[model samples]
Target: METANSTHTGSHAIKRQGPQQSHNHPLRKDFFDSLSYWLDSPSLAYSSWLSEQKLKDSTKTVYMAMFGRFCQWLNEQGRRLDQLEADDIRRFLDSANPNLPQSRKARTNSGRQRQQYVRQLEKVFAHLSSLGHSGTNPGRIAGYERIGTGSDKPTRFLNREETQRVIQLIQTELDELRQEEKSTDEWLKYRDIAMIGVMIGGGLKVSHIRRLTLNCMDMVEERIDLSQPGHAHRARLLAFAVPAVKAWLSVQEQMHGRKLEPTQKIFEADRSSGFGRNSKTVTLSASSIHRRTQRFLAMAGITGERASAQTLRNTYAGLLIDGGATDDHLVDYLGLQASVTAQRLRNAYARSQLRPAGGAHLSKDH
Candidate 1:
């Protein structure tokens, strides 16, 4: 057990509550299927912590998926898991190619992205050696690549108008449902709208919002307490209670015509089944969130803007940062997945604010 001290911004590791439990615990079974576990002891809560720490679902998923695919490939290639080395990764990076039919889904810089995955692979390799799974970290990427080999690219965010358009579209969709009772289950509209609103208002990432549990909220305090995914030291908090966000959630609860329990997911695709994913309850995946975001953006006529829930979150950051929100504020407020992630958004905000309006066209003759 771990005993942690709760600070206003983050939790501190004060002391060990008791003996460290083995990673072989049943609840965390098969958890090592993730490549990250080869680096450290497995924990079911690690994903949640990672989600919080990374603050981007796609980011978290992409790396996990990439590693998963590679490991699966290794097994098929008649290679022992322990025998896997940096050269295997290097070969994959060197010959990285997207499936021809699947190229339609290819993101920009397909080769480079695969190569970048090699870096993460490097970390996991080092970790595996530490964990006694391998004798050598043979899979590490070459040194020249780390300092920007022209393959690395940054992620993008959105603007305020774009953000408004996303919300507006979702609103329009909900309103249409209101006009013609899309389904007897009216909570769908309420749930989506409220979810988007909280996400936008708080500049929250999908993972941050998705992992939310019923017990984390304190409606009376108009705040929600986030317990995990600490970024650095200061960013980690015992709680992250935003009063404005609570207002949105409150309205959602009222519209549902029932008080929300602390144990309920604030946003549920299915509000029934006791608000848990049981044997019967269908669990939602990261892709579902992406698809829903696309639908909402298209409905709002902002389909061309971007395809992500985080885009709206970024839009919120850009809007506020442009309007004078500080870089530090944008970083924490948006739960940025990386330390430098806010830089480009900050640049966008500055560009939007500082760009001259068609230039000052006063001539000396005039």
Candidate 2:
């Protein structure tokens, strides 16, 4: 029977010692020939390095597979482990074959796979640096930090019925407030209605809404201009939302008992000391607006991870897409920095159209 001290040691056990050998080890170049050789045979040194990272078993397998491919590629390029530079790493990443190849021809790696490869290389180079084998972490300088997975969570938007229910609830409350005598508390409700109306009608971001001032709204033109110093959007037309906005302005004027200055913020927190002659006003914070919007959503029976003002803006964008607005129109209307973003939103809208109304799952019978 074989014993621990037997001369019949595993082939991998001998090759695995290459990674842990001295920096000037004679067999160092052979180790880079193909990490898969030792990995498939089960390397003690590679397993130890993966264990030191405290990674999951599945993650360790993925990392080892990617690292093995990289080592093989380096060997093909006649590149030594200690002589790597950032540019060489970048070239390899751009030219490397995809792990899951679709055809015989080598294909470029996906953004997600590229990110994973760079991350694995970063760990490898860092380990080598600690061992005094490599001078610099070329993986980090190869732009791992800048690369993204190129995937985003599906966008969340309300259906037509849900959107109308929320708007109806707001209009009902706004009507009730108009009938009641004006007060400081009532002004907040008016502001919330106007803020939500603009969000749904204009697709403005939370930051744009927060920084809005009296001068930003041209009620006569039924337009909201956001070309203010810090705002990103230029202007957005307000359709079907003019009444709520005008009502809020009237209520605000009466609450302050004077004409509102153009510079006064349109959405400010209700002051405990009534907004009378000399009361100081505080701007409504982003959280305050989110909470207000969330309450409206809860009242309308719409609840989810995305039950906030962003959902309202998303719904607004969906409306524009459904109305046959072009991609360029969306880019201008939504103030999106990239035209690709408009394309993605259009794709999302198309995907939403394929789903059952209100996002219901398909029945098994179908």
Stretches > 4 Å off in candidate 2: 1-151, 181-185, 228-232, 235-238, 273-281, 360-366
Q: Extract clashing residue pairs from model 2.
A: none
Cα error, residue 13 of model 2, in Å, equals 71
Tens digit per residue, CA lDDT, model 1, 253-290: 65445565555555555546554335112333444555
Model 2 has an lDDT value of 0.62
The alpha-carbon lDDT assigned to residue 318 of candidate 1 equals 56
User: What TM-score quantifies how close candidate 2 is to the native fold?
Assistant: 0.54
Best by lDDT: 2
lDDT of each: 0.46, 0.62
Worst 10 residues of 2 by lDDT: 8-17
Q: What value does the lDDT take at residue 282 in candidate 2?
A: 62
Off by over 4 Å in 1: 1-154, 170-184, 218-224, 227-261, 271-283, 337-344, 352-366
Q: lDDT for model 1, on a 0 to 1 scale?
A: 0.46
